[model samples]
Target: MEKYLEIIKNSYSSYWNYLKNSVFMELNWENYFYGLIIISLIVWGLEAIFPWRKNQSLFRKDFWLDTFYMFFNFFLLNLIVLIALSNSASELFNDVLGIVGLSIKNFQLLEINKLPFFTRIFIFFIVVDFVQWWTHRLLHRVEFLWNFHKVHHSVKQMGFAAHLRYHWMEPVVYNSLKYIPLAIIGGFSAKDIAFVHFFNITIGHLNHANINWDYGGLKYIFNNPKMHIWHHSRELPKERKYGVNFGITLSIWDYIFKTNYIPHSGRDIELGFEGDENFPKGFIQQEMYPLGRKD
Candidate 1:
């Protein structure tokens, strides 16, 4: 119990220090703190120069709201709640495994650290994205999960920052689901796969940006704004009522699984789910929305 408390304490202190360095710009070139800002700027700049929805305002509706969602989801809640909970949960899970005479290390399918650096990054990227792809599908297909996911689908207008306008519960779901598969294929540190993680964030931002670029045939391999905008379309096909285009960093999965759908450029499609007119506009209201307690 004391060790558990120490872990909790250290999580808060360590992540707090990270948040301080991030906010103060004291991080190295690869820090996600500055990367978030720089990526948003670069994508927003692209949208401004060559927007798919040309008439959409420079500051689109709910633009600032989505911007706040970016930081809040990325840092604030993690510092205050998620880090401690996840660290403690990991410890408990490891203890449970130890009781079974099996450690996480026992399940290792590959030593990622021993692979070529680029191979390691690529493997981690594909596996992480594939796991998230299924998780994304579940977020739509399952009724209960969809409630938490509605905060993201409630976006009425799409922009770069809108990439991160998801419920706080989402990372809990994503990371929890990612933990086992990643741990099984373990032996790599966050620093080892930082480039892939950064690339994933960049792709996510660009996917939600108001730009239409598919990179010709490369669209088959990578998720692009053109294909992803349809994922936000209010009117899905009758057969695909739950959702479509469930890809994360890669479109190959969607293409392979037949979830990809883009009959035309989705510049003017109505965004958001059914009955979205009543969706809350304020951040607190939206955060509370999934709990059936909009304030």
Candidate 2:
């Protein structure tokens, strides 16, 4: 237990410095602090200029709430998770491997570092996106996971910020499940391609934005608003009660797996699940929502 406590302590200290840098002196080109704001503004601008739903309000319902969610999910909640959870998880997992005289580094089936820099990032993007695709399916098919995901589906009005208006637990599940698959390919640190993170953020915003572009030919390669709104439809397709369009950053998985569906333009389709009107609107209440406590 002392060792675990020590690990948490170190995690806190390390995260503190990183957070301080991100908050203060880390305004460099790669800084997500500024990137988040910039990317959000760009998408919001596009939506305002050419909104698919011309009748919808610019200040849509829960717009500020979803904005808070974007920052919270990206920064505030991340701090707590890194300090108190992920560090211990990494250490414990390594210890378990130690039992068998192995380490995470031992599972490098592809030796990814030897590959070209762009090649590594490209592979990481595809593999990680695929893992997230499967994890998304789990969120819908598994009742327990769906409860957490409901926070996201609670968005009645889709906007750029709606991309991140998910229960914090979603990231925990996404990251945890992606760990092993990434490790198999030498676990290339995501930092190797800072642009990959930015790219996903851009796509995520666009996917949930109030836009109608399906990227024409590239629609299958990348997720877009037209292809993704069907994902948030309140009613499920007759043949797909488990949900559909489980893509995160790319739509290829959905097309390949036969999970893609768009019967029409869906320019003004209803969003949210049944009973989402009862979903908590306050951030605190929503965070506690998956715990089965309405109050």
Candidate 3:
């Protein structure tokens, strides 16, 4: 009994220390909160001034629900799942690669840290974005995955916060596969990762915001709100087998894959999946929705 008690005590102590060091010690809550606030203000301001759907209110349908989704996804789900999965996957891959006598250190395709700062960011951005694009296409193609991804498509009104309105399992799917190529290309510095993250956040916001800007010919390179709006269209275009415009950052992938579809104007476009009106509206219900419940 004494030995068992000692073991339990040590386990608890180790867990507590890990929680303290890994979470509290590294987490910069101030920066996170301040950054969120600043970005929200800027995006919200842009949406209000240069509105897409005219006369649309800020407090449109499902606005608060999307806000809840944004917080839940970023703060709770992503923080836990991404950190755990990434660390575990890294360790697993390292061990597996070591057994084959090819380690990331020796067999790395690109020494990203050795590159210039902007170049490193560009490379990381393109690589990660390609991964996201592929994962997003998978989410739409696979029926089981679509059930979870439907939570995102159920939105009738698109706002800045709507970008993060996705099922909790989404980050698990995306982040798990995203880092593999990066790992093969060599490890990135913390700064490079941050740079890519910043661009992702900005682009994600703009893509989902209630703004109408295509960036003209640049739309073929970078995904704009107009391009992404079609992605949420209820009816798939005649030419596409699955959904079109699967790109997250770059539309080049969609064009190459022949999934690109952009109408002259998105003004008449009605968003949301078919029969989504029957879907739940509250955050909790939406979270529970992908479980195949009739309710």
Q: What are the models' TM-scores?
A: 0.96, 0.94, 0.86
- State each model's CA lDDT, in order: 0.88, 0.87, 0.78
Give Cα distance to truth, residue 159, candidate 2, Å: 0.2
Residue 259's C-alpha lDDT in candidate 3?
86
True-vs-predicted CA distance for residue 127, candidate 3, Å: 0.6
Angstrom error at residue 13, model 1: 0.4
RMSD in Å for all candidates = 1.8, 1.9, 4.9
**C-alpha displacement of 292 in model 2, angstroms?**
1.5
- Cα error of candidate 1 at position 140, Å: 0.3
Candidate 2 clash pair list: none
Candidate with top lDDT is 1
- The sequence of per-residue lDDT tens digits that candidate 3 reaches over residues 1-295 is 4544454555555444544554444545324444555687798899889988877788777888888777777666634455555565676777788998977787677877788888888888888999999999999988888888999999788788889899988888898787678777866786677667767777888888888687788989988899998899988755564688998888899999888888668756789887887988888788888886543
Q: Per-residue CA lDDT of candidate 2, range 50-142, in tens?
A: 899998887899999999999988888877784468778877888999999999888878988888889989998898899899999999988
lDDT value, residue 145 of candidate 1: 85
- Clash-forming residue pairs, model 1: none
Candidate 2, run of 10 with poorest lDDT: 186-195
> How does residue 58 of candidate 3 score in lDDT?
80
- Pairs that collide, model 3: none
